[model samples]
Target: METNTQTDQVTNYVYIHVPFCLRKCSYCSFFSVNFSQEASSRFVKYLIKEINLFKQKYNIKPKTIYFGGGTPSLLTAAQINLIISQFDIAETEEITLECNPVNITNEFAKELTLTQINRISLGAQSFLDKELKVLGRLHKADEIRNAYKLLRAYRYNNISLDLIYGLPNQTKEDVEFSLDEIIKLEPEHISTYCLSLEKDVPLFSKIDQIPADEKVAEFYYLIRNKLISAEFEHYEISNFAKSGFESNHNLCYWNDKYYLGFGPSASGYLDFNSKTVCHPERSRRRDHLIRYNNSVNFEIYHKMLDEKKIMIDKIILNNDDHEKEYIFLGLRKAAGLNLEEFENKFKTDFTKKYDKVLHKFNNLLEINERTIKLKSEAYFISNEIFSEFM
Candidate 1:
């Protein structure tokens, strides 16, 4: 990591990347390695060392801690506890751990109850056996159900389930079946994703089987309507939650709050200062934001930590970069971007700054006195709209 400048701000949110998985899913593109007991144990030691090094530099009292993966649940409960012990987490803090349904054994779930992980995000990709097979998921449909029941048995009330739609050869009925199963389970939160085929993934070879954009739009509305009818708030484009159960850690990202990231391939955003820029033409205050990601290669990650050095790729954001990110990331929420907040933060009139772009898609946006957001009907093509700001 770069040396902390005099103005670096403290971050309350922490994300630890656990990059070990038994098998990588066919359509996944995240950086991860094959899981092994010896490797994971060594990774945990280095992860803790990395955390302690940061702790020495900053006073970190984490309000939310997230362990995201390549299947975070693959770590033993004792290992999870050891990493978590490095933080001073309050009972009210949201500590989330992502799990593969097949890995949520009875003993594992029971042991997790003893840890500070009060929330669970289960990767129950699909409830259909065929879809699971096509996606190269290790768990079957029954395993998803059993895992849910097991978590409930262990008293984990704050659970979120993940579902993927727009799969190869997927049908409206297939989506409905999965949604029906999800509703029946009644998790506190639900995150839905459209299968995106990356360049080198196995699913890219079968991209021809993917549904048309129009059909995918149909699926999106189908899901939004179903989840809304079931009383789940469509908080973000790809996330829905029951009352008071939103993922606090993820909310930090959409809300543009500073956070710290640990482990290989994890990225973090931090603000150095909130002072106005010294440029002659611009009068707006700009956040001195810096974003960095750890090395993706395991060997380099370990070597740097062993030498007490932080190996990261870093970027310092200019005013334009910050403004574009503010617009796009804020627009992801259902409540939309607050115009008042934007004008105050950037010291520019929202309408005057993006006048031409606003006129281009006037019908697709819902603008009012305090906030501006995309209309629900225009969500499927949101990326095209977001590009205007980019």
Candidate 2:
């Protein structure tokens, strides 16, 4: 990490990545190794060391902590407590852990609640058994509901359900069935993602087997309308939340707040304290923003953590690119870009700066005195709109 100093403004957000999985889903691309008692124990020790080293290095007090993973639920309750005890967090901090159905147990859930894990984001990809099989999930469909009941039994009310649409051989009926099941469970948050077949994943070669582009578009629209009717706010492009339930941890990223990341294969963006070049919504003391990535290889990560000699891949952003990124990220939110905030931060006239691109997307984007956002009808093509900023 780049060395910097400030009397105030220490990094206030933290993410710890756990890269161990029992089985890597066929469509998944996250880094991971097989889970085992010995390996997991060592990983926990190294993570504790890594977190302490960075905490001392940066003097951070985390306001929100997310335990993201190949499968964070793989950790035993004792291990979770051991790692979380290292952090200096507030009493009201949002501590979230990820889980999959196969790994959840009623006893484990009870133990987890005792460790201060106030939130759970379950990877219940689909509520349909056939779809689960196609997605290579190890758990059966009924287990999703069972796991939800278990979490509720442990008083984890702030739960998020993760689902995927645009799947191979998926139908509109399937989409409705899944959403109906989700509404019945009544989680505080819903994150629906389109299936993208990236290179190297097992699903890439069989793209031809999936739903057509138009069909996927319909699925996206249906989900948006249904989720809205269910009283969930489409706060971000891929995320919906009940009122007052938006994810603070993820909002930090979209809002351009500085954060720290730990563990192998994890990434962080810190620094860049300065007034926005064109907009005045932000004023700060950051000099430059740098994004850094830790070593993805496990052995190298452990060695560095043990010796306190970690190396990172760094990219320092320049002013123009940074301004562009601010636009790019802000546009991904359902609340859209605040025009006055944009102009003030970048110190440019919004209407005049990119008139051509704005004109090109006039119909697809909604612009008003207070905001500029993608029209709900145009959200399925948000990627195309995002590329204009890129």
Question: For this target, which candidate reaches the highest lDDT against the unseen true structure?
Answer: 1
lDDT agreement with native, every candidate: 0.88, 0.83
lDDT of 1: 0.88
Local accuracy of candidate 2 as per-residue lDDT tens digits, 1-390: 333332245788888898899987878888888999898998898988878766545667888889998889999999989988897776437888999888888888888877988889999989898888878889887999999999998888899999999888889999989999998899999999898878888877768878998999999888889999999999998999999999989998888788878888998887644222212433432236678788889888877776765435667776677788888888889888888888777788877887888899999988887888888877888878878866
Clash count for each candidate, listed in order shown: 1, 17
Residue 351 lDDT, candidate 1, scale 0-100: 83
What TM-score, over all chains together, does every model reach? Answer: 0.94, 0.92
The deviation in Å at residue 372 for candidate 2 is: 1.4
Clashing pairs in 1: 1-310
